[model samples]
Target: MKRSDLSHTIRETLKRLPPPYDSHYGVVPPAPPEEGVSVAGAAKALDAAQAAFGKVDAIAAQMKDPYIVSRVLTRREAVSSSSIEGTQSTLDELLSVEETGDDGARDVSGKLRPSGGVVPWHQRIDFAARPTVGDTLKS
Candidate 1:
């Protein structure tokens, strides 16, 4: 069967099936019907379902036409040199990484060692107190 037909069948089957059930404190509650199952609800459900089904149908229809599919899938030549650059800039902003200058750049040494350089005595003591995995060798 066609993919769209199969999808519609599956959707219909899901609609006919009983809703899920829930349990609380040894009590089981009957499953609520799928959203918009009533006449009023069905209208809303039908609209949404039709919209989604329409999209799938359109895609399936396109797939049946090899020329249309080829046109849809064919890579087009770059329209503008800055298209990729613009896309990257938008991505950088979305990622919260500053794309301007070296503002966000990090220095490895600064990360490994902080300013004023000396390790605190308490930290050193803690390090000495830590038992290395190799300490089991002695046991």
Candidate 2:
């Protein structure tokens, strides 16, 4: 019931799989607590999470407007998400594009803006519009 035991089983199973089909199948089950991790390691991870929560709570308590913090973080995440999709735009540029409602916003290089240049207002209205597995893991 150790990690090595699981790896060994997966390795042997893979050897029996044929080409094309081999890469298509996987046998990785979540390890039960009794099989996978040491209790001490779990305790340490829990303690770390609690400490992080306390620190974030303290910071939130001091913020005059927590909504501003949420807005900034959301904008940052938008920029990062766009970057992952090969769209290069900054927060200020994104805001300007949104304000102007223009697709012709010029980049610093004076070229036409990209598709993700401005997050569509509809997408912004609902943060729950999650990417599908294919969309997220696309090369």
Candidate 3:
């Protein structure tokens, strides 16, 4: 906005700045309306959210086998962390690996494929890690 408009706004807000920038100012956003949302609608949404949370809590609390939970969490962590580290695999692919004991398979092109059937995102080859000529040679 124009400096003059900013100065006028600042004066209306009773705020002051130092030096030549005394005329410069930032606009303060107006507070939200107290009655913006209907109370009944908000209450219904909250109830639904609470019900979903309670269901999850109940399932977690009722875990009959600790090993099952541990195994699930471990696989989740592995898949998630490996994706972050670029040695990526999906949870389903990881589970498939555990079941089949296969590290990798070749696609029709004979190139290394991430997983079978549809191409999962994480399984796509990361070509950026490939070493350039400079990487292979001395200075």
Candidate 4:
């Protein structure tokens, strides 16, 4: 093995600036999707979406009380969402906690949903009208 003499040059690295840096927060609107593009995949996806939405609309129409429907659906969704976030709270326990305050029965009673009472009616309505897949992707 032969040892070769090599002079290595050290490059000076730029140091990051100290705290109190300038930051600007701004919202930039996305450009609208162009019309009249005959993409095969997009058309298929749109059709599937319309079909799914039609089924949902039909189910919604059959329900006598939209409020109760929304409440039940929202509670189920909330339970799933909470469980994903590592908080395990069931629908019955959630309702009980909302009615009589947290009695320490469930570990996550206080954390799930609004402080008192079920999720607000307005919030549920907003959830129902939330943007669909085609709406966001197409527009």
Candidate 5:
């Protein structure tokens, strides 16, 4: 529809959606591979991806400290999200907080301080005491 043909007001146009549109939108499924994408090319890309994953899997399996990978990834994700939330936090600060066990010592501690802050379940449980693993009620 051209702008010249639109005689209705902005409010009128918006109030009623045309065909294939409604107040609620449905989820769109993932698109199929493009028509031009050759089966050979797709197979080659899949092979490369599988090879890379195999190398990573082998390295991860051989690591003495597997949890370090998790910590590193968590810190990296926290650092990236800090900017979006208008917080100035560093990877070193996050690592230090976790190591020192300061108040609000979490991945996002720099963002959410301990003053009426949301606490993670990990912090609630006293791991040192080991009082019935599931019982977080123990003070």
Candidate 6:
């Protein structure tokens, strides 16, 4: 069958599945393919499928009883917030190090020093010493 037909069929099948009694009950339908069944069309179909799955998940979530939902929501919120805070802290550390140039450099003792160099290590290759594979292998 056509890609659209297959996508629609999958969506219908998912919707037919029973939703959990305690959670949001909604299904985000997949978007129809804009073009024919090419790579791009396949990508679109995947996106649609993901959206539809998200909807179903939300619906199922809503179907849950209120107390359980509240507890779960609270836990999720806490975890999310904690995760965000952790990410923010990490980002802040990265940015601060970038700003101050303290991203773990090497000291005279071979210890990792704070980052504070003009250029990144990867970009600072020794162009002068660079030899082609043929040159290095030549007798």
State which candidate has the highest TM-score: 2
Tens digits of per-residue lDDT for model 5, 1-139: 4445544453234343446676532333445777865689889999999998788778778999555555565566666666665554677866676678675544454354442221122233323334464665653
Q: Write the per-residue lDDT of candidate 1 for residues 1-139, one digit (tens) a residue.
A: 3335444435444322233433211223456787834588788899999998788667777675434332221212111222443321222221222234333323333332222111122234345555588985786
Task: Please list the residue runs of candidate 2 whose C-alpha ends up more than 4 Å from where it truly belongs after superposition.
Answer: 1-12, 15-35, 39-46, 90-105, 115-118, 121-139
How displaced is residue 71 in candidate 2, in Å? 1.8
Ranking by TM-score: 2, 5, 4, 3, 1, 6
What local lDDT score does residue 86 receive in model 6, on the 0 to 100 scale? 40
- Candidates ranked, most accurate by lDDT first: 2, 3, 4, 5, 6, 1
- What lDDT does model 1 reach? 0.39
Regions of candidate 5 where Cα sits further than 4 Å from its true position: 1-16, 19-52, 104-139
lDDT of each: 0.39, 0.66, 0.59, 0.56, 0.55, 0.47
Q: How many steric overlaps does candidate 3 have?
A: 0
Model 3 regions more than 4 Å off: 1-25, 34-37, 65-139
lDDT tens digits, residue span 1-139, model 3: 6555555546566445677889856456566798785589889999999998788667767887433544555566666777566664567866666567565744346576665422232233223334479976952
| TM-score-better candidate, 1 vs 4 | 4
Residue 14, candidate 3: alpha-carbon lDDT: 49
Poorest 10 consecutive residues of model 3 by lDDT? 117-126
lDDT preference between candidates 2 and 5, better one: 2
What TM-score, computed on C-alpha atoms, does each candidate reach?
0.20, 0.46, 0.33, 0.34, 0.41, 0.20
Kindly list the per-residue Cα lDDT of model 6 for residues 1-139, writing each as its tens digit.
3335455556464433355643432345677788745688788999999998788678767885433334333333433453444422222333344468655734446676443232232123323335578886993
TM-score (C-alpha) between model 1 and the true structure: 0.20
Worst 10 residues of 6 by lDDT: 117-126
Q: Which of the two, 2 or 5, has more TM-score?
A: 2
| lDDT pick, better of 4 and 6 | 4
